[model samples]
Target: MLLAILLPFLSFMVRGKILTGIVCLILQITLIGWLPAAIWAVLSLNNARAERRNDKLIRAMKENGR
Candidate 1:
């Protein structure tokens, strides 16, 4: 929840997605576009999490000789 609030900054700092973060921040500055910016940031975070999970699962399966 806190991360969502700071996503515009963290997106580049933590996620290495500088362009995305910049765009989101710009959108947020427009007032009316804040919701879309938040939504985009959340979706990006979700996709990153899912990709990490899948990578971990694949590694575990390989280790188990699957």
Candidate 2:
């Protein structure tokens, strides 16, 4: 998330998306895609956290079922 704030490109790179990160870096350098990149990073982080929470809930439910 910090990378999302400091370098939007690093966000994608940290996620193992080298190509996308490179592209984002180029776009960011252009000075026009910064806003979109920030928004995307926020949304991406939120979605990832939600998925992790849901996975934990599913695991708990299965454990309780047994």
Candidate 3:
């Protein structure tokens, strides 16, 4: 919720991808392009979440000696 509001800033903090955040911020500065920026932020966030989940699953498997 709050992430969606401060996405241009939080995107870098959460994803550690400064370029992506910067691009989104630039897009957002163009009022007509703000929607695309928001959509990109959401998609990027989702990708980051999936990557984290996959990493956790791999770590659990390794810990279990799988």
Q: Give all TM-scores, in the order shown.
A: 0.80, 0.81, 0.73
lDDT of each: 0.73, 0.82, 0.73
Cα lDDT over the full model 1: 0.73
Clashing pairs in 1: none
Ten consecutive residues with minimal summed lDDT in candidate 1?
A: 4-13
Pairs that collide in candidate 2 are none
Stretches of candidate 1 exceeding 4 Å from the true structure = 6-9
Give lDDT tens digits, candidate 1, residues 1-66: 457555554664567877767777787788778777777777777888899999999999999995
lDDT (C-alpha) at residue 29 in model 1:
87
Badly placed stretches (over 4 Å) of model 2 are: none
Which candidate number maximizes lDDT?
A: 2
Q: Write the per-residue lDDT of candidate 3 for residues 4-65, one digit (tens) a residue.
A: 55555466556677776777787888887777777777776777789999999999999999
lDDT of 2 by residue, 3-63 (tens): 7877888998898878978887877876678878776766777888899999999999999
